[model samples]
Target: MTDAELDLVFKALADPTRRRIIERLDDHPGQTLFEVCAATLAEDGSGLSRQTISQHLDILERAGLVRTARKGRTKIHTADLSPLRLVAGCWLGRFIQED
Candidate 1:
């Protein structure tokens, strides 16, 4: 990933809500906006608005952390960890040595 793309990935993960959203999508892929909202509420009792979650989803999508697809009339979201794995392997992995 380019510096800008890495920046976007880091930025997207910088937020607590976005991280939680990523966690949600990771555990359960292909969830609609409403299902995401419901799961978030059920998990933490957070009263986050749908619009707020939608905005977070947008950020994740831009960072290549989340992917969205149309399921009939609804849009379902899934987590894509390639960028994260790339970052970990290419950037962070350099810091550690195999024993």
Candidate 2:
């Protein structure tokens, strides 16, 4: 990924809420807005509003971290870890020492 794209991905993951959303979708693929909100509340009791989660999802989408599709009238979200893995391999992986 280009530096700008990498920047976007890093920026998207910089937020804890965004990271949680990524984890949620990673564990359970294809979730709606309401379902995400419910699951997050059930897990942490944060009671975050649907709007807040929606906003976070938007950032994830822009960063290529989340993929969204329309299933009938409902919009579903899924985590896309390709960018994250690319960043890790290109950047973070360099620091690892081979045994």
Candidate 3:
């Protein structure tokens, strides 16, 4: 991933909420907005509204961390790991020296 792309990835995952969402998506792929919001609210009693979650998804989408598609009336969101893995292999992987 390019430096700018890496920046967006880091920025998107920097937020705790966004990180949690990513973790959830990692566990369960192709989750709709309602499903994600429900799962998040179930885990956190504070109740993250659908709108808020949508905004978080927007940020993730812009960072290329997630992809969204329209499925009838609902929107399906899925995690995209190519950029993440590319960044890890290109940037983080380079930092680790051979044993």
Candidate 4:
């Protein structure tokens, strides 16, 4: 990934709520807005409203972390793995020194 792409990914991940949303999508794979909101309440007990979760999802989508598909009238959101793995391999991989 390019630096700009990495920046976007990192920026999106900077928010705890967005990270939680990513985790939720990781576990659930594909979930509609309502399903995600329910999961957040069950796990965090934050009672975050659907609107708040929707906004978070929007940010994730913009950062190329979350992908959405239309199923009839509902939008199903899924986590994209390539960007996360790329970011980890790019930045976190530096920790492993090859002597």
Candidate 5:
């Protein structure tokens, strides 16, 4: 990933809610907005509305950390591990290995 992509990824993960969303997605590969909202609400019981979850998904999608697709009436969201893997392999990996 380029510097800007890394910046976006970090920025997206900076929010606690977004991070939780990522974790949830990691556990549940393909989840709809309702499923994600239910999971979030179950964890905290604060009840995140669909709109709020949508916004979080938007941020993740923009950062290239997540992907969205329409499935009939619901929109399915899935985690994209490529960016994280890229960063880990290129940026973080470089630090641990000798030149």
Candidate 6:
């Protein structure tokens, strides 16, 4: 990934909500919007709306961290780990040694 592309991925991960969303997808791939909305609800049952979650999904999709497939009336999201692995192998991996 280019610098700008990496920047985009980092930016998408910068948000707390987005981070939780990613975590949700990582644990349970192919989750519908409603499922994600329910899983992220706070203790008091107040959390992000469907619209807000959708927006975050869009940003994540654009950053190549996630992908969506429409099945009937629902959309299933799957985590794409390639970009993150790339960042680890090509960028962050340089910082550590096998020692």
Per-residue lDDT of candidate 5, residues 56-99 (tens digit):
99989999899988888877888887888887797888886777
Candidates 5 and 6 compared: the better one by TM-score is 6
Collision count for each candidate, in order = 0, 0, 0, 0, 0, 0
lDDT of 1 by residue, 1-99 (tens): 678988999999999889999998999999999999999899879999999999999999999999999999999999999999988877777786454
Candidates sorted on TM-score, descending? 1, 2, 3, 4, 6, 5
lDDT of 2 at 93: 78
lDDT (CA) for every model shown? 0.92, 0.92, 0.87, 0.88, 0.87, 0.85
CA lDDT of 72 in candidate 4?
Answer: 90
Q: Model 1: residues >4 Å from true position, as ranges?
A: none
Cα error, residue 3 of model 6, in Å, equals 0.9
TM-scores for all candidates: the values are 0.92, 0.91, 0.86, 0.86, 0.82, 0.85
Q: Identify the superior model by lDDT, candidate 1 or candidate 3.
A: 1
Of 4 and 6, the candidate ahead on lDDT is 4
Worst 10 residues of 4 by lDDT: 90-99
lDDT of 6 at 43: 31
Q: TM-score for candidate 4, please give it.
A: 0.86
In candidate 3, what are the lDDT values of residues 10-46, reduced to their tens digit?
9998999998888888889889988998998888764
In model 2, which runs have C-alpha deviations exceeding 4 angstroms?
Answer: 97-99
User: Distance (Å) between predicted and true CA of 92, model 2?
Assistant: 1.9
- Residue 87 lDDT (model 3): 79
Question: Per-residue lDDT of 6-51 in model 6, one digit per residue for the tens?
Answer: 8978899899888888887998999988888888885326567789
Candidate 4 ranges with C-alpha deviation above 4 Å: 96-99
Candidate 6 clash pair list: none
